[model samples]
Target: MDVDARLRELGLELPEPMTPAGNYLPAKAAGDLLYLSGMGPIRPDGTLVAGKVGDGGLDLDTAREAARLTGLQMLAAMRAELGDLDRVRSVVKLFGMVNCRPGFTRTPAVIDGCSDLLVAVLGDRGRGARSAVGMAELPFDIAVEIEAVVQVAP
Candidate 1:
């Protein structure tokens, strides 16, 4: 399938790939696996959905949207690395972290926002192993941060 075409069909446009805020690269390739650094749900204007889940006015639904935004950022990074989304073979794994208030435990459901978006865009190729955890705080207090491992055409 033409992944880029699929994105268009879904009425989605790729955001600009984000530059690393630190010294690490956005993505690194090792054989078939492309490892993506932790990506935040940054909007086109470069604003983040900053807050803690279940606190500071952030809730599960909002945090879920943040996760979806992170998925978009992930794809943006992937395209920047491979030059095309069609180069992707499958999503392998995802490690999602949500910034939350104490006692928040619905992390998995929040990260599913990203998972669902991936499947909506990539079909079966989007299915993958995943883990979601809560964090006391994340860099910049972004609502969610996600790192991914993907398989790409070689």
Candidate 2:
């Protein structure tokens, strides 16, 4: 199955790439590898949903949803660069940061929001190792942040 159909199977819709907030580039490619910048859950409407998981404002489920949104944004950035998700060879690595209370123990679980979404969208090619961390804070105070390193076709 193709990328779009796969997304439909998972009931996901990828939005257009959101404009970069500042000077940073959306994504960069080196050799066969593409390094996607950390993407936050800034909806196209420009409103920001900012909070931390396990924190007072953002709870675990909301944080997980934010991570999933980040994954969607990551695909948007990739499509902006590579034209099609078919260029992706493999999702090599994913780095996730979740804002949480001091003793939050579900960091990895939260990041599964991204991981599971990627696989749902990209199929087996999206499966990859990942690291999820609890961060003190993040830009825009978003609930979660995610970056990815992926191999693309020649």
TM-score of each: 0.97, 0.93
**Candidate 2 segments whose C-alpha is farther than 4 A from its true place:** none
Q: Which ten residues in a row have the lowest lDDT in candidate 1?
A: 51-60
Report the lDDT tens digits of candidate 2 across residue range 21-114.
7998999999999999988886657556687677466777877878888898999899899998889989999999987778888999889988
State the lDDT at 26 in candidate 2: 90
Among the numbered candidates, top TM-score falls to 1
lDDT of 1 at 83: 90
User: Cα deviation of 45 in candidate 2 (Å)?
Assistant: 4.2
For residue 147, give model 1's deviation from the true position in Å. 0.4
Query: Which segments of model 1 are wrong by more than 4 Å?
Result: none
